[model samples]
Target: MSIYTIIDADTHVTETPDLWTSRAPAHMRDSVPRVITDSRGTHRWVLAGGRNLASAGMTATAGRGTFKNPPKTYEEMHPGAYDAKARLKYMDQMGIWAMVMYPNVGGFGAQQFLKLNDPELMLTCVQIYNDWQTEWASADSRRLIPITSIPFWDVAAAVTEVRRCAAIGHKGILFTGEPQYYGLPLLGDKHWSPLWEAAVELDLPISFHIGSGDMAEGLVKERVATYGKMAAFTELAVDIFLRNGLQLNDLLMSGVLARFPKIKFVSVESGIGWIPFVLEAMDYQFKGNSVAEEHPEFDRLPSEYFARNVYACYWFEQTAPRRLIDKIGVDNILFETDFPHPTSLYGDEVHARIKGGLSDCEESVRRKILWGNAQKLYKVTGPSADDEAKL
Candidate 1:
């Protein structure tokens, strides 16, 4: 077993070129998403009739020094981004121990499938992705945990997929923080009660990765023409990370967390430094607007629900690693590498970053943030990848 103890709360995979084709049923193989090169020498993911859901537009910028031009093909990405064993080896070299995996081809929350407008295809795509992920994680379940994707267009189907993936060992759910962006019912709507209920029962955390139909989508679209693609791209690179704050407010006030107190709502890849400002502001607005009186069932302050049921992850943030841990709450904070992503901690940078950024933190506090919190969140057990892989 690796002597280190760190469980990355959020990381992504660069789905192989044949990710869908290799797993898709014979009848549906041609219809599944796959990569194709355009006349401009850029590789992009497209569906059957070339319905454009762009990933090469920039999502694969892990090792690329410039965000403007990411890898045009899977051949360009760090092998660990797609290869499971390579990922484990990289983690061992970096001393990361374990990591919770997110997605790319499915648009982070499977929002890409909803765009197809074909229910059967959408659901099938989600199932295939989850099944593939489960099989992939079987490489090292204790270290590589997959968060299942769901067809958010159908809540009942989502509930069913949730249960199925849970049974198969997916540790959490990747959900869209703003489903209404796609004209679906809000998370607080009774229409979603089943999903919330199932998550609580199954004890699966609902992780809303940034850009999963969150405000960032709206912001980038509106700003592109005005700011120009170059400027918008640079701004969006960081702006999207903080846009999750929008969900934090809505969730705290919408009574979703209050009603489903046991459902651990995770704001993934969104740094935790903003938690104090936003949660405090949410509490201020809650009292100022008399929301407390209007909502008697919300028996606690907004920040209280955050401390009780919400989690926010952080990386490359010095202030949070230094002092915000107390304000953000120790247990509610989790460490993440966001590995192989443009903003990720790279290679041996992990040890130096932690030791330098969190130098003041006691070892116990650092341990809790690094792996202890994730162990409880993802049900990680025993020795990490190296040891678990041997079994």
Candidate 2:
């Protein structure tokens, strides 16, 4: 079997109750999000309305058997859920040298923070969350990289938070790609300019990750609420694709990309199959006078800007990576293992999955998708071909 060192761009872990209560400042930690596991080992998030966001349906097991519910404690997931040494053991087993982690409950926490009405409270929560991620990544200096969440409702505060995350050693910022904050359109507002400018200046890529708890509804409705959380999770993967194209179109048409040429934008967990059609449409639209008149700064077409400034992360089973590399360019494609998700088992299974999908001719292309692209994106130094070959 041909071998390669994988860098999973999208592995995730849920937060346990003790995360904030034990690690955060006393007053804030007690009121922070708490985790609940059922007798069956099923896990869910318990928040203000007594709402429980279920995790993978099953709970934590004592060792390896399936739990009736998800594990109630973080320790059940790993020695320290964010500990680097524990993660490195798993990484070596899986042939992964590094991973970037997103928050469990913090996916929806940013939206809730926006609703709190006080910007101070919103900023504080974001600050604490970013700090937690920094500490978690620092636990294993070499293997884990953390991504920070943005409080979009407060643009200036959001810029401050992005810079803060960078200063504290975070790799990037995560946003939901929603324009409105509780029915208000912050899309065209000038307030977000600083946030965009900060990202450009700090050299941090802005990632639009799908599937926050309470998402904006008007854009796309790919699923219903009846089928439980899986419906939402499936729909989230679709929503990020739909809204990213919409938001990217807006940014390009509105001159955001032109204004911030150096800023890189990544659409994560959104499969790659849709790129050709989207790029084709934009290229066609720009050829006519329609797109040019809206923004004079756009000298090249939308596809050119996309190739220059944007990238898409392909999940393990997706068709996009193997199928669309030539169209999207190998440099713009990256690999991700949605670790601990229903689809991916967090072990050596990832190696088989990657090797199984890559064609012989595409081996070089696969290397870029699996590691090189991410190395460039995260600006982290990793093993060279000769060094990796020796493994």
> Mind giving the per-residue lDDT tens digits that candidate 1 earns over 256-295?
9888878899999889888999988888888899886888
- Number of clashes in model 2? 17
The predictions' CA RMSDs to the true structure, in order, are: 2.6, 4.2
What TM-score number comes out for model 1? Answer: 0.92
Native-referenced Cα lDDT, model 1? 0.83
Deviation of model 1 at 45, angstroms: 0.9
Per-residue alpha-carbon lDDT of candidate 2 for residues 262-322, written as tens digits (9 for 90 to 100): 9888877666777778888878878876767776777778888888888887766536555
Summed over model 1, clashes come to 0
- For model 2, give the RMSD to the true fold: 4.2
Model 1: CA > 4 A from native: 55-59, 214-230, 384-391
- The whole-model lDDT of each prediction reads 0.83, 0.65
